[model samples]
Target: MSQTIHINRVGLVALALSLCANAQSPQERSPIGAVLGTSTPVEELSTKASPAVVHIEVSSYRTSADDGDEIKNQTLTKRQGSGSGVIVDPDGYIITAFHVVKGARRIRVELDRRVRANSPAGELLNGKRRSSFEARIIGVSKEADVAVLKIEAQGLPTIAFSESNNLKQGQLVAALGSPEGLRNSLSLGVVSSVEQQIEPDDSLVYVQTDVALAAGSSGGPLVDIQGGMVGINVFSLTQRGREEGLGFAVPSPMVRFVYGQIRHYGFVPRPYFGVDVQGITPTLASALGLPTDSGVIVAGVGPGSLAQNEGLQAGDVLVSLDGMPLQNVPQLTWLLLHKHIGDRTRLEIQRKSSKIVLDASLISEPSDPEGSIATIDIEENLVAKLGIVGSARKHGTAGPSPTASGPGVLVVARLRESDTRAELAAGDVICSVNSVPITSVAQLRATIESFKPGDAIALQLERKGKLMYMAFEMD
Candidate 1:
């Protein structure tokens, strides 16, 4: 009976194939063929979104030998990496993962955007013309692994962003990327879990999916059936040597928020809450004599901060913020993220036995000094060797630099592509170069040019009221 059943199943499959082969007209074709034909929704969605999707190639330097007596001296070797990005602006703003371009000395974008003589950027080509452009890092948020890039082109294709708030578990999503450097590959999968915290105590959340992701997949867009971007593919959780089904993406909302902040400030504004809080577990609540088990407790309050100014103290159990119930640490951070600097909010905490309410406003730490690099003079401020626009200033005048006293060069801006082997950021005050005091922009430039490639240089930097040192090789 089993043999007979197997024979019948094979005969049915053969009959179906013969019928499909015999069909020459559309009307005679099988419904299955038509359903899976060239005009399917998936195909249409891919066609609509693939143009805006781009392949990102990054180049950075790494040491040939990290450790061992056999290799006492480390040599710089060029390393290449690939990832994916989506065009968010027609004027050439692309968004990708921070890891894709971090520590990269050079970044290049490969897109299908039209490259006409007068075209904006990538234009749909006939596989004949090359559409590649060098991109500059606009800003990056390491916490979320989102980075924004800018290319010098216009009329570029861009993808539309859809609200991810309503995404349900088991919803269909497609990932577009160049897995293993195979460009324009698309895979389909379902949302495994909406909220996934890969790390403990991390305030960031990811959109976990069962989507097929590989090495070259980071920074790609995870879109819905309608070709709307829902998330950016970040990483995959692999066990041993297999990738059965574990992928994660930075949620669209968080990416969008970071993008907006970076575009304006050239960095994510660090919100200074002046207070630290943790979740109130059952044990913690009982020990603290709190009323409820599920809540948040103030761990510490910064001195001279608005929290302390408004009577917020340690051991205070926070009940709500602006009437919204507080539960965990992530939720508190998320809620506070919605509040920008100067935004006033109401907080209710269970202090001792009474319910006390405190009203306070939010503030932020000093923004990235690179944000003010605009409109710099080309001739005087530009330090080509170090790739920074600088100005001379007195240390104790602006803010006392305990290490230095008189004149130093203030870094107003930094160019992404430079031979400098270290991260000499804007807002850093250069106190000296290799024990030789640097007073002005000319002195900084001259002192830097005095050293040649392979020479080691140490710079004393004053950043955010602290003195530190940055050392690197001249390349």
Candidate 2:
């Protein structure tokens, strides 16, 4: 689960369009339209972009539908799911929605039929596309609902990202993906809204469209008429049980930002400012008798965090960060993600009728902890139910914190690809089970076996120098 973010540089290819076309006589036009029959923009776009719009196949485990007792006792079953991914690199980097591949034991990508026809191997046997490649996860951002994957190939056809903020309402868009296992399906629509929140409290936004999204269309690309990537298709509000014509996509700007972070760090890292801020409201401003009716008011500051260390505290109004004005939480959240570890950023604060500035370095996660790792070759070290092998924590072996002193069982390897409920990594140290400290492999196994099927289990683990809890139901 530990990863370092990096980037595989990609080139942006913009398809140029004619702003105006000359008038044509009735005789010159075809029945639908000469443009439709001839060099249609969408036709050209599909030609250019479809090669990179790949069909993804995933295999994962899901609980069965059964009675309470039967469900608890039954083993998990495998599920086959299909989605679409857009290749973004010539070296075979593909981007798709995280949900499409979440908890997947295996992932495979099939290139477009046209690409398969020209297979370098010169033949298709077993009815398989020679271009089909197994994909390895580069990284995933669950919050943003995006995942970057890589296939072993060279000189792949790729779709480049476009500026999503430049998109306006009513702009023509095309949806490309495999819907119902039919690869290279295309649908036309218009931009319904540039940005919208699915939930009132959630900061993540989507580009709304009236696209004809059917089942199995998730993770596809919503491209402009010229074929530039505008967003990755997430979900439709529905054709419902009735047609609502509602669909949404994660904007490309956010995708580009997240894609870069995942490539670099294996995940998106929201930089820590240590100060929590709330948006100023007219009512609150009146109640507090504050100067400005709109601004970010600091609610609290984390102790020992860089902000607290830099002299930030509660009740202070955050006027701006690195000179940009801040007014709302979403804006603040979006801005903070741009800061990386070791980067120094300036914060403008309005405190007690005076403005002051403080510079602080971003460090939400610490450096990797150097420690001894256990070997899983021995049978006695296996924690079979958890799908991991373990060993006792030894003297001088620890996480980043010097204060993390205790007996714990260290994970050696993860054996079950299907049992990823805990996402336990090799270097992780299982410290406790339901608050009871674990000191050996047998103890950990015994503790898990003690629980009944469907019983809740919470494990405290130290991973990559940080302590965190992963909870799941015993099965």
Pick by lDDT: which candidate is best? Answer: 1
Tens digits of per-residue lDDT, candidate 1, 27-83, equal 664735533455545567778888888889988543323213254322233478899
lDDT of 2 by residue, 1-475 (tens): 1111111111001111221243355455442353345465657777888888999998843322211334222223457888999999887789998778765668898988766423444455587546888887887776678889988776678899998899988677878898777788877777879988664235577999877776678899999978999999988875336647788999999999989987888768867675666777787778877778876787887666667878888878878889999867667778878777678889888887889998866766422211111112235665767876578886446744754646798775555333646667666889999999998888898998898878888999887667889999877
Lowest-scoring 10 consecutive residues by lDDT in candidate 2? 4-13
Candidate 2 residues lying further than 4 Å off, grouped into runs, are 1-38, 61-78, 117-129, 198-201, 275-300, 314-317, 350-356, 365-403, 406-429, 432-475
Give the worst 10-residue stretch by lDDT in candidate 1. Answer: 1-10
RMSD for each of the candidates:
9.4, 9.8
Clashes by residue pair, model 1: 113-122, 113-123, 114-122, 114-123, 120-154
- TM-score (C-alpha, index-matched) for candidate 2: 0.68
Q: What ranges in model 1 sit over 4 Å off?
A: 1-36, 61-78, 113-130, 278-296, 304-306, 352-354, 366-445, 448-475
